[model samples]
Target: MSTLLLSQDQVKELFTMKDIVEICEKTFQGFGEGTVINPTKVNLDLGETAAFPPYKGFMNAMPAYIGWTDIAGIKWAGGNLGERKRLGLPYVTSLIMLIDPKVGNFIAVMDGAFITNMRTGAQTAVALKYIFNNGSSEKKPIKLGLYGAGMQGHTQTLAISELFDIEEVRVYDVMKAAAEKYKKDMKDVVKGEIVVCDTPKEAAKGDAIVCVTQSKDKFLLDKWVKPGTVIFPMGSYQECDDAMLMNADKIIVDHIGQCLHRGALAELSEQGKITEDDIFGTIGELAAGKLSVGDYSDGKIVCIPIGTGAMDIAVASIAYKKAKEKGIGGTYSFV
Candidate 1:
C-alpha cells in the first residue's frame, strides 16, 4: 500500500486562490443540482473550564462524500476559546483525511486549518458573485464592513478583495488593538481603504457587511444596515440578532437543511423568529442560476454559511492531485 503525506506548508504551496475558487464553483454547482452527498456535522461538547469564567463550547467533526468524483473524507476539528487562550493558541485546531473510495483506505492526511479558512472564504466569494450585480454600472465601488479580526476575518477579507472591486472596508472588533493589527497586515494585500470602526453600527454603514465574530449574544442590529446591502454571516452559531434576519429581503445559505438544524440560522428558528420557509434558497442555487436574488428594494440580502465539508474535501482533493503532478509530497509503500 502506498500513502501520501502533505504538511501544512506543502499544502499551502500547492493550492492557490484561483484553484480554490474553481473547486468551490464545481462543488456549488453539484450541490445546487443535488449531485453531492454531504452529511450533517457532528458536534462534541467540551465540559466547563474552571480556568476561564463562563467559557464553554463544542468540537465539530464533519464527514462528507462527493458524487461525480472518487473522493470521500472527514474534517475533524475542535475549538475551545478559553482553553486556547490559556495555551496561548487560536481557538480552533483542525486536520483532514482523504480516503480511497474503493477500499475506504486512508490515502493522505493533511492540516485542515488552512483548508477550513480557505474553503470558507471561497464559499463567501461564490455567494457574493451570485448575490451582487457585479456588471452593473455604479459610480462608487462597493463598500464592505467586516466584524472580527481573527483568521476567518483575515482570510475572508483576502478572498473578498480578490473577487470583488471593493472601495472601502470598515472593521470592528472588541479588541481595538487586534483590529488595528489586522488592518496593518491586510494593507499589503487589500487595495481598498481599511478603516477601524468603534462599533458594529459604524461598520454596518457599508454596502456589504461580513460578520465572523464569535459572539454568543447578538451584535448586529437591523436599523444600522442600509437597503440593497449584502450581509455574509460567517460566525456559525449565534452571531446576528432576530431583527437583522427578519428584515432581510432574501436569506441565502450554503445548505438550508443543515443551516436550519444546528447553525446560526438554527438558533433563530429555535427562538421562533424564523423558520425553514423564511429562507430564500442556498448559495448553490444562486450560483447555478436556478434561484434569483429577486427584488432588493425592500431590504438587504443575507447569506449565512454553515461551513460545508464537501468544499474542504474538494480543495484537499485538488491539493493532492497537484502534489502528485508536481512531485511535491513524498510517497511511501508499506507491506
Candidate 2:
C-alpha cells in the first residue's frame, strides 16, 4: 500500500478558513440529523507533577466514519503546556491519520494543528451566523471584543472578521506584549482597528465578546456585558464565571450533549447556574435553519465549543485528497 505524508506548511496552504467553515457546517448538520457516528473521545491523563510532566499529557484519539461521505479517519492529539513553554512552542500538538475504508489502508498522515484551529474558528463563525441577525440594521458591523492573543484567538478573530462586517476590535491579554504583537500581526488582515485594551472588562463591552484564554479560573464578570451582545467563550473549561451564564438570555453550544460533559457548560451546570432546559439549541440546528434565535435584546447570548476530533478528521480528509491530486506529499510503500 502507498501512504501519503504531508507537512504542516503544505497542509496550511491547501485548506483555508472558508473551506473549513463549509466542512464544519455540513458535519454539524449531519451530527444534528443523527447521520454521523462520533463516539466520546478517550482521554489518558498524566499527573500534574510527573517526572516529565511537561511532556506528559493526555492523548485523545477520536475515531469516526461518516456515512454521507466516503471518508474515515482519526485525530490524535496530546497536550503538554509546560513542554511547549520550555521549547518555545505551542502547547498542543496533533496528527491526523486518514484511512481508506474499502482497503483498510493508511491513506495519509498530516498535521492536525492547522485543522484544529481552522475548524474551531469556522465553527464559531457558523454559530454567529446562525445566532445573530445578519440583515438587521442594528447589528451591522458587529463590534467585537477579544481576550487572549494565541493561535485560537488569532484565527478566531480572522474567521469572524471575514464573516461579519465588524466595525472595531478591542483586544486584551494578561501579557500586554502578546496583545500588542497580536494587534500588529492582524493589522493588515482585519479591516477594523485592532486596539489593545488595558483590561478584560474593557474588551467585553462590545456587541460580541470572545474569550480564548487558558486561565483555569474565571476572568470575566456577568455584570459587565450589555444587552444584545453575544459571547463566545473558547478558553479553558471554566473560563467564564457563573454570573455570565446566569445573565445570558440564551445559551447555545456547538454540541449540547458534549458541552454538558466537558466545556464551560459543564462547569456552569455543575454550579446549578443552568439546567438542560436552559440550553436554547445547538449551532447545528441553527445552521441547518431548523431553529431561530429571536430577539436577543433581553440579555447576552453565549456559545461554547469544546474542541471536537471529527472536525480535525474532516479537514484532514480534504487536505489529504488535495495533496494526492496535486502530487504534493511524498509517497512511500509500506509492505
Residues 1-335 of candidate 1 have per-residue lDDT tens digits of 67788888999998777678668878888888887678888777664323434556466788777765668898888677676779887777788888889888788788888888888878887777777753232323567889998888888877766666768889999999989999998987667789999977888867778888777667888888889888887775557777788878889889776787765677778877888889989877876669888668568998887788889888888788888889888766543
What does the lDDT read for residue 24 in candidate 1? 87
What would the per-residue lDDT of candidate 2 be over residues 211-289, giving only the tens digit for each residue? 8877777887887888898898876466778888877888888766567766677776777667888998877677666
TM-score of each: 0.91, 0.91
All predictions: root-mean-square deviation over Cα?
2.9, 2.7
Worst ten in a row by lDDT for model 1: 133-142
lDDT of 2: 0.77
Whole-model lDDT per candidate: 0.79, 0.77
